[model samples]
Target: MAKKDKADKKGGKKDKAARKKDAEREVVNGVFAPLVTQTARSLRTLLSRDLADCGLYAGQDGVIQALAGEDGLTPGALAQKLGVKAPTMTRTIGRMEAQGFVERRADTLDHRLTKVFLTDGGRASLERIAAAAEACEREALHGLSGKEVKTLLRLLLTVEENLQSAIGKR
Candidate 1:
């Protein structure tokens, strides 16, 4: 009887593990996560290739664009706007400063606060960045019609909202 009970417990454990795996499979296969991940990877690859000529990476252009819209933004503010951590922003800003793309200036009102400003080089490179981005988008959406593009945008926004809600729960 003891041996039979031990076997039953082992079978129960196996059943539990199988149930967990089924749940995981449902999450992975049903969630569109793989599609989203692959699409993101493909877009990043295309963007990297296009931006190579300008000597800027995929994420750096965002900073340039942000600065173009609102110059003299603090590092913390830029980090938050870009959805990046402070250290990562600091490293990127440091690299941009070294490459003469941006400069750090001490705020007049608050000497402790440093603001980032785009240099002449950064402003000049904006055209190239814009061209590269346009080319990448055009290539990615080569076959999509205007209406299809709009539909795709709507669907993607919906997906983003769904994911945002899921993240909020966490």
Candidate 2:
């Protein structure tokens, strides 16, 4: 019975070790989903830190860029354009308003509806935010050549389409 107990303990330890290795292997190469998610999260953290110097958050830059292309969009319209939820867009816009980066205007046709516009500060901040974004991209792709960057972008877009298709099927 003593020998059997010892053997069982050894087997249990081996099983645990094997499970740990499997988890590690999964993260390393088993599936692309975990890798893609980790890459996205890491990139967001890096970009957020860099954007902080410009007084903007990671996701806020996208909103600014969208607004820059077309100003005075309703909150819902902006949310749809950015692919963000309505509540999230509202919170972001509220923060930007508090920071003096955006302002809300009553829609001329409908007083009840509000539209978002970039404030003077927001227009000026665009240059800095753009530079920060470029710098972050350069840093992230420091070792990659132009061809490699293009390849990476193409691969990412393909992955995005695959995921979108999967979501649509669901």
Candidate 3:
């Protein structure tokens, strides 16, 4: 296992001890996890509803958002940006191309290299979709205090960074 993964596992001791002080703590009751399912479902459901006019899915939004800043990217680059398998990226791009979200063309500098770029529709959809996502996140964090939200975001970002660093080693 990677050093980061080892460190991630190392935190269990602290977490276990911290929870031991509580007289009663909430427990999940599912084959999967309530926390995981709730957030995932909420994001997907909200995005689907809010972005319906945009003609995009929750998974496809990442590519559009990435292309919004950068003019174009190679399949390998897109895969990295989305943190997905190369084959999965290929399929997603193929579907997006069919949907006219993105287009592919041979690179001018390297004829063999094909790059992906967003269509005008893709660009327009992204701005609204992003706003919708921001709203969704705002709603999700509504009950939490500012400090609690910041801490939660910090912890989630740490986990993302740690796993990303470990993934790069592979």
RMSD of each: 9.8, 8.8, 11.2
Q: Which stretches in model 1 have alpha-carbon errors above 4 Å?
A: 1-31
Better of 1 and 3 by TM-score: 1
- Per-candidate Cα lDDT values, in order, are 0.92, 0.89, 0.83
TM-score to native of every candidate shown: 0.80, 0.79, 0.71
Across 1-170, the per-residue lDDT of candidate 3 in tens digits comes to: 69888788779867877786552343333433567678879878987778766777667888888888786799889899888988999898999899988999999999999999999878877778878899888887889999999898898788679878999999
Q: State in Å the error of residue 91, model 3.
A: 1.9
Clash pairs detected, candidate 2: none
Clashes of 3: 0
Candidate 3: 10-residue stretch with minimal lDDT: 23-32
After aligning candidate 3 to the native by TM-score, how far in Å is the CA of 60 from where it should be? 1.4
Q: In model 3, which residue pairs have backbone atoms overlapping below 3 Å?
A: none
Task: At residue 64, give the lDDT of candidate 1.
Answer: 95
Q: Which portions of model 2 miss their true places by more than 4 Å? A: 1-29
lDDT of 2 at 157: 91
